[model samples]
Target: MHDTSLYSSILGLSSQWHIANAVLDSKARSLRLDIAARSCAEFCCPVCGGAAVRVGADKGCWQHEDLLNMRFHISAVIPVTLCKTCGTNRISVPWERAGSCFRCMDNP
Candidate 1:
């Protein structure tokens, strides 16, 4: 059985951002998600609060937890926006903590 709480949490987190969709693939054991927002003008720099330009593209993968003791992997095709003013590359996502998985309850 799937845990509704987990699904709700994922949906809530995605809602906080400009996410297009979030999917949990049990067969692939991965959460495939994407974010939808303006290409350059409206997007904000993830590192610094500055205007960003679409410089390149990248993907990130992390390990999370599912219902019960099952472990799930999450992959996001995040855009690599470069801040011309700050000269910093930014990726947008609701990351709970640095180097911490979303599903992990342990404090690092």
Candidate 2:
């Protein structure tokens, strides 16, 4: 059966985001999910204490743990911000480490 909630729960994803789509490659035995944020303006800038706007996203991907023989990955264009003081900046994802390209647990 097709299910995003199961994977979402496994990922411990925050309520602010949801899986937009899931791509399965049976031949490669892999799965990739595209996620989207519910809101963007709720967050503040890390560089400066300034109000920020959600500019868009920076498409990035992260490899995650496997489910049996199938590899799982999460991909998204990370939401960006246009801070009044910091100019333009990419907002951090909750699942990723500070300044790291991949997730906190995943090896890059």
Quick one: best TM-score, which candidate?
2
Error in Å for residue 43 of model 2: 2.6
In angstroms, how far off is 18's CA in candidate 1?
A: 7.4
Q: List the residue pairs that clash in candidate 1.
A: none
Question: What TM-score would every model get versus the actual structure?
Answer: 0.53, 0.68
Which 10 successive residues of model 1 have the least lDDT summed?
A: 99-108
RMSD of each: 6.2, 4.2
Per-residue CA lDDT of candidate 1, range 62-82, in tens? 556653354654445556777
Model 2: weakest 10-residue lDDT segment is 99-108
lDDT of 2 by residue, 23-44 (tens): 8889999998888777533556
Error of 2 at 66 (Å): 3.4
